[model samples]
Target: MEVHAHSHTERKKWTHYLWEFLMLFLAVFCGYLAEYQLEHKIERDREKQFIRSLLNDVSTDTVKLNNLINVRNQRENWLDSLTYVMNSQNPRSFPPADVYYYAIFIPRSIPLRFIPNDGTIQQLKSAGGLRLISIIGYDIGVRNLTRIGEVEETLINDYRGIAHYFFDGIVFDSMLDANNIPRRPKYAPQLYSFSDQNLHELNYKLFSIKAYNRASRRESKRLLQQAENLLTILKKEYHLK
Candidate 1:
């Protein structure tokens, strides 16, 4: 009876140890699963936030572009009205004020150098339009047509004189490098750093606008959307009412 009782006690002890071990294993497994789930959730939230931020940036840029276009249209309309009045008064006797208008009232250049030629400039000027030349920068290397450095050199050289002569502002194309350019990362530094030399040589009231690239449509759209949202926030924050 004593031996049987001892055997029974040992059996119970072994069973208790087994149970404790199983429970501990289960607890560790549960903790690991919880940690993994929490990490995954955090990662997903970060990605979503980044996308939203990029979209806001893009939207703001779009709004700025729209505002610029509206201003240009208004100027053009005013010039047209002035031209009509001068022409009605007397075509030949229309004062040399037209020349002054053209000298000042040209539209700023786009990335493609979309500027009216001398004749068009003269006509618009005569019509009392300002000679605003759009400052443009073209990225040449993407299509393998020209090297980026070569293009940059040419643009700098070509526009250096033009900058002084005709350009109202400098529009830099591909202004930011791939890394520095806005992306999904919350705190990615600018991909391309602007050299002092480039900045000094291309000096003008800089208007940094991204040129439309087919390859980056989705990203661009997201960024533009983000930009627009930011603009709204800025307007409100800055009391730009």
Candidate 2:
């Protein structure tokens, strides 16, 4: 039998295997770091985009709040004027048509012009993104604004309750004649005629209505200032337009 010469095969060293393992581990670790950084970047960009959108909502709220404030102020003034007329020694001196025009203006409640532009805010809050707003005091500021709005809403609803519960419906029914009410600009039309006793009753109701309006007007003005302050902080903190 011919003995075949064994081919010399060198055994690989354990250190060489260990070196290959180390290289593989390092590559994986670096890839992980790169992926993590990419994800972090994406999250930051998304956060900024959401903040910008939220800023627009706040701006809209600011406009609405201002307009509501103006309406409340004007209505309060009209209520004051009506109070003077009703309490006058000679209620007969003032033309009844003029009284009707002003009295008819007493709204049951100021139309809800206050629309909180909270869509983006609600979305961010629902998604747990409010935590991402890093501006110092921003979160606190937003919370305060919401609280102010709550108080304003509560006061408005309270006044509505007072009006409905305390007021006689006869005045509103007599004042509004839809067909004849809006006949012309600056035109004073005849309203449902009031007897002397009816005038006495209406005079009392008008006083109560004026009192309720004054309370609501005060609340509205306070809310307006708070809203303006919040907007100022938002602009300063976010550098928004």
Candidate 3:
């Protein structure tokens, strides 16, 4: 009877030890799995951050490249203007040779397709003459009147149009006052007329000087400076010269 009781005690101890071993093994396995999952998550987050940083760097570089191109283009245009003036019959009429300052206002709704061809731009550039060609506030007909609200949209559309027409830029010259309106009003009849008369490739700027009713010299200068600042920013930001 003593021997049987000892055997039974030993069996119970062995069974308990086996169960404890299995529980410890399972706990270790679970810990390993949890650690592996956490590592994978951290790795993914790191990759995402790396990709985002790369994209931002690429964007910044693109902007810088564009600015550099614009500055170069502006310098070239200035040189060309000077050359044109030197060869012109009357340099006084071509103020662009010396004066690089002007304010050009583009309308807000005209599509870029309406801009004349590159010949027009080239002619203007060669002439060293600047003018504003407005696409808004002109009476195309008795029923059609150009509207002005969102200037940027009109500008982009006009840009596209000018590009399509092979024009390097636009000119804003829409009549704003009732007195300035002609009897047979048209949208930039002068530009359209020029476009029709001369089929030349032109690459020049869209130019304008805002006509104010009672603008003082200081006010006019301030406005002109503001336009120049905007042009500089556009050149730097978007590489537009």
Report the number of the highest-TM-score candidate.
2
TM-score of each: 0.35, 0.64, 0.28
Question: Candidates ranked by lDDT, best first?
Answer: 2, 1, 3
lDDT of 2 by residue, 156-204 (tens): 4444443433233454465556753411224333344345665555556
- lDDT of candidate 1 over 1-241, digit per residue (tens): 4555343433567888899999999999999999999999997665445434433433444654444445445444544543353335343344334422332332223322212112432333465543222201111111221232234334334444543332222212222246433112222112123344544443331211111121123333343344445545545543443
| C-alpha RMSD by candidate, in order | 20.8, 5.8, 19.6
Score each candidate by Cα lDDT: 0.38, 0.59, 0.34
Between candidates 1 and 3, the TM-score winner:
1
Over 37-76, each residue of candidate 3 has an lDDT whose tens digit, in order, gives 9999997665445334433433343343344334334434
Q: Highest lDDT: which candidate?
A: 2
Clashes of each: 35, 0, 24
Clashes of 2: 0
